[model samples]
Target: MNTSRILRTTNVVLLLMGYQRHWFEKTSHRFRLSLPSVVYIFVLGVVYTACFSQHFDKSSSTLKVLKDISPFLFGLIRVQLALGAKAFAYAIYSSVKSVGAINSLLKALPSRNSQFTQDEASAYLLLTSTFGILFCFAAYIAYEMKFELPPLPDAMLGMALLLPHFILAGSVRLYTVLSWLSRGQLKELKKNAEEELRANLTKDPGNIASAIFTVSTEGLENLKTKLEILEANFCIFAQSLKHSMLFLFAMHANCLLGGFYTLTYYWNTWYVLFEDRKRRIFYAANASIYAFIASDYICLMVVLFMMENERRNFIEAIDLLLAQRKLFSKKLRPIAKDLRGVLKKKCFKFGGPFQPNIIYVSLMVCLQIIIVTLIVTVHYLEDEISLLKEEFSSTDDN
Candidate 1:
């Protein structure tokens, strides 16, 4: 009963938040914002909670599995929580800035078309904001289920490790929409930048400026949507960064889950079968599994690396505009410089708010790796070795 109430509350909250975000986005299909993807994942999570909550004790094994994995899962999730909170702050800033940018650009641009027919921009913003909201809800559930909030640990770790991945899957969906919104803008920017650079190099085109975009031609509703899109740039930036970490965590979970499930299945066999038992075998398997599991982690780091590299490249690219920073339309270059500075600093300080404090986080991370390798061995190695043993016996008999 309590569970049901909580779920109902969650449902209402999601609906309300989704509604507000949609308003920020100035969506035309106002009726449809009610059915965001967050609602779906929310419903699924609620249903899952309800189903499991009823027979909580009767289903010990399954619950146990969840409990076992909860710690590491919670650790990873806390990081996500921190990221989401940061994203929310960014979104708020972007929403206000986007509105300002659009208004400023509208008043500034006399030649460029102010009337945009398509509202892909709204869709992009809507998807991005809703994704963040949904992810937060999902993370909350994970933190509660896995950690001390409601006190359901055990196999929760698996879910914890897995929750980010699952959330990421949803985020990827939003990214697709954002990629569409960015398509034309990216091309337009590139073309203008390239042409301006060429013209300048040839004749030093004395302070060439690109065009401003606006939607003054659209209706009030469309204007609102454009306003949302304008703010959504920062939202999109934060959203993009958040998804990256999600992707890394998900990949790590995938490997961990793979290894752990294998180990669980072959746990009994190791007791009777081998001297070092399945422990040694599992360790061997962990190495390979860890590689696959961490592959995504590696990819995640690389993506961030590349993003940072691009920022640096942009700073280098705009040498001509550096002198006119005050006159330039955007002011994010300063922030970009700060971000780049942090990345450049090779000296990683140990104790700080920016970095995590929990020593157990490190332990769980290592443990997660070890467990993953063993699980992999159990799943893949035993069968192959068994087959080889069989073949040898057959040869001996012959």
Candidate 2:
């Protein structure tokens, strides 16, 4: 494979796995931790010490104890979540790599017509640059969290986490463009076949039946070749897609837990921070980071929807070919039948069971709404409780 082309056409799912591995190795080089890793460890150690070192009274209320220890809990949960996501990504990478000859088959497909138009290229560039800027903003927030100068290491870690998202977005854009080109080629081939029939009729009027049969045979051959290549590509994609779904699920779970902790346990602190002029920038930065992460997840889901749509298009194209019952040769009929059978048997599924579609997207949106509703409810209840306590104390004084 041409290294540059591979990078350009790289699957985002695989790229994420590679980034995880890269991050791990770079941070733990020679058993010496990177600055970010060191800071993370130190902060975690301090939290642990505070929890166990009798800094708070042993008889404190359960809620008070939990409030003090929530940071530690959040950190532990996030680390485990990161590990789970990495493991899932690795599994997906292995599955994709094990598909023999698929890589070369992908490369063998004609590339002449696959070049992106200017508008398509600009759109992709804009999307990528937008994500890149969002990630940089995230890195800035992460660094500000520690009040550190020369925040290069923290910023790099933030970029590392987002690297997969950037690559995935670019890959999806490229795939869409390539699919468009393929469809255009099929249309052009059909037009050419019509012109060929007209020419043959003018040149040899008596052998019309033979000329038609020959033209039909050639057209079937071309269509069959293209379908075969596409089928192989989809097979590889479907397998990797299954693994990607797993990773996405794991990440979603992590995000849910982290978001819950932030809103439930740290909301007061966040509100106070936002009220301070000097700290308001940090608050906004952190909020933006979370927003971007949420958006990235939604974007990945959208890409999967697009991929599934493309799969349907391939099946429809094959169906259209088969529909011309009188035109296809006996050999061509069997080829089309076999292709349809393969597609029927292999489907892209989530967690090896649920097939995702528009309905899945709807459910995800509803879930987010429910989570936000719960957060708002909690905040309201807390406010009411504090108000009641103040009223009771005022009554006693009177």
Give the candidate number with the greatest lDDT.
2
CA error at residue 316 for candidate 2, angstroms: 6.1
- Candidate 2, superposed: residue stretches over 4 Å from native: 1-108, 113-130, 133-215, 260-269, 273-279, 294-298, 301-356, 368-398
In order, the Cα lDDT scores of the candidates are: 0.39, 0.45
> Which TM-score value belongs to model 1?
0.35
263-309 per-residue lDDT for model 2 (tens digits): 55456555553445436554555466456545544554555555555
TM-score of each prediction: 0.35, 0.55
Model 1: lDDT of residue 377: 61
